[model samples]
Target: MKKDDQTVTEATALHSFDAMLTTYERWAQPCSQTFSRAALDGAALPVGATILDVCAGMGALAVPAAELGHRGWAIDVSPGMIERAAERLKPHAGWSTEVMDALDLHFGDNEFDAAFSVLGVVYFGPETGTALEQMVRVVRPGGVISVVNWAEPLGATFFIPVSRAVDRFDDPEVGKFVAPLTEFLEGPQLERALSGAGCVDVRSESVSGHFAVPSAEIFMEELDSVFQVLPQYRAAIAKDRDRFRDILVEEVLLMASKELPPARANIAYGRVPTPQETVGSSGLATS
Candidate 1:
């Protein structure tokens, strides 16, 4: 991506995240925390390993890594997110946070023992591979690079109600409002991205869990908090927010009665090849 386009993308992400900052912990952090722990387990990093958390929203992954005695940097595009992450990491030393773009990591090459992102880089759209490449670039050869992304079908259960609600609206643009948030990368696709970025021994596995909201009312409230940040959603409902909310609530309530399905994620990890290992793989190498 061009520098100008990167800047625009960062600004847009910052705006959306800042708006979600208020309800983020209550609505999203629980699931993020679950995935973060899973990612850390999958990484199997040595204690005290230096780490980098790309697009580290609210320090979900960083906090767990710190508890495991791993310390490093947590970076996000939103100042608000970095600020919140900093607050969460204050209890643990040797950890810092910065408002940085994942596609443009500022740290030196091979500076970290491991680097990871949890449901963060998948939103980069066409720039997703660039983001993964940056993560691979900063980790030491033989160090781990890990990421957790929502898997398809099951990964999208939570949003099904939202899509159903959008269908109630006559405007076609209503569908576009939720499109960005619903896109997901499957396990094989994630593995390819990592391998394409020069990571070896790549592996991906499916992780499953539940999303438990107390009630439909809470679900709608959380969904509303998220939608408030999305300009497309705002524009789509500009005519009658109340009516849309009502329809959304109805759809959510109906879905809730049927029991929300298990949420599943693809946790993928791979290692950067060391020079000796790289050479060994090439025919030019001699014993």
Candidate 2:
């Protein structure tokens, strides 16, 4: 992506996240906490290890790592998110949050024992590889780099209603809205990205969990906040916002009434290669 495009993407993401921050913090806590634990477990960090949480929204991963006795440095593109994370992490010593871009981390080489991003980074779109490379660069050799992304099918579930609403419009431009919301990396695809970023012994697995919501009405209310931020969603409904929302609300309520399957995620992880290991693998000898 060009620098201009990347800047626009970041700005748009920050805007969406500003609107999403409250609902996400409330409705997404259970799922975020669960996935954070899974990512940390995959990293297998020693206690007191220095860890980095890239695109660490609201400190979901950082808080758990801090509780595990690891020192954590969390970074996100949104100042609002960093502020919220700082508040949550204040009680823990050696835990901090910074407003920073994932594609260009400010940390030094091998500054951390491990690094992770949970339900984050994949949204970087075309810049996902660059962000992962930054994560790999900041971790010490032999340190783990882990990330959790929503499996495509599971990721699409929440947006099914939106898709249905768009279909009612029968317009190509409106249909484009579904693509961005549902296009997520599967396990193998994610592994390729990680391996390409210099991680070795890369592996991924599906993790199943669910978001805890009390009722369909409340769920729709929280979710509507999310849709409002999507520029495509706004544009699609511009001609008939109320009609679109009505259809979407009805679809969501109906879907929620049924017994939905647990949300599944792909958690990929690998170790950074040590100098000796790298040389040995390359069949090179040191002087």
**What's model 1's overall lDDT?**
0.78
Tens digits of per-residue lDDT, candidate 1, 83-152, equal 9999999999999999998989998899999999998887676788898889988999889999888875
Best by lDDT: 1
Candidate 2's residue-wise lDDT over 122-169, tens digit each? 767787878888999999998999988877542635666676667765
TM-score, model 1 to reference: 0.87
TM-score quality measure for candidate 2: 0.87
C-alpha lDDT (0 to 100) for residue 181 of candidate 2: 32
Task: Provide TM-scores for the models.
Answer: 0.87, 0.87
The number of clashing residue pairs in each candidate reads 0, 0
lDDT of each: 0.78, 0.76
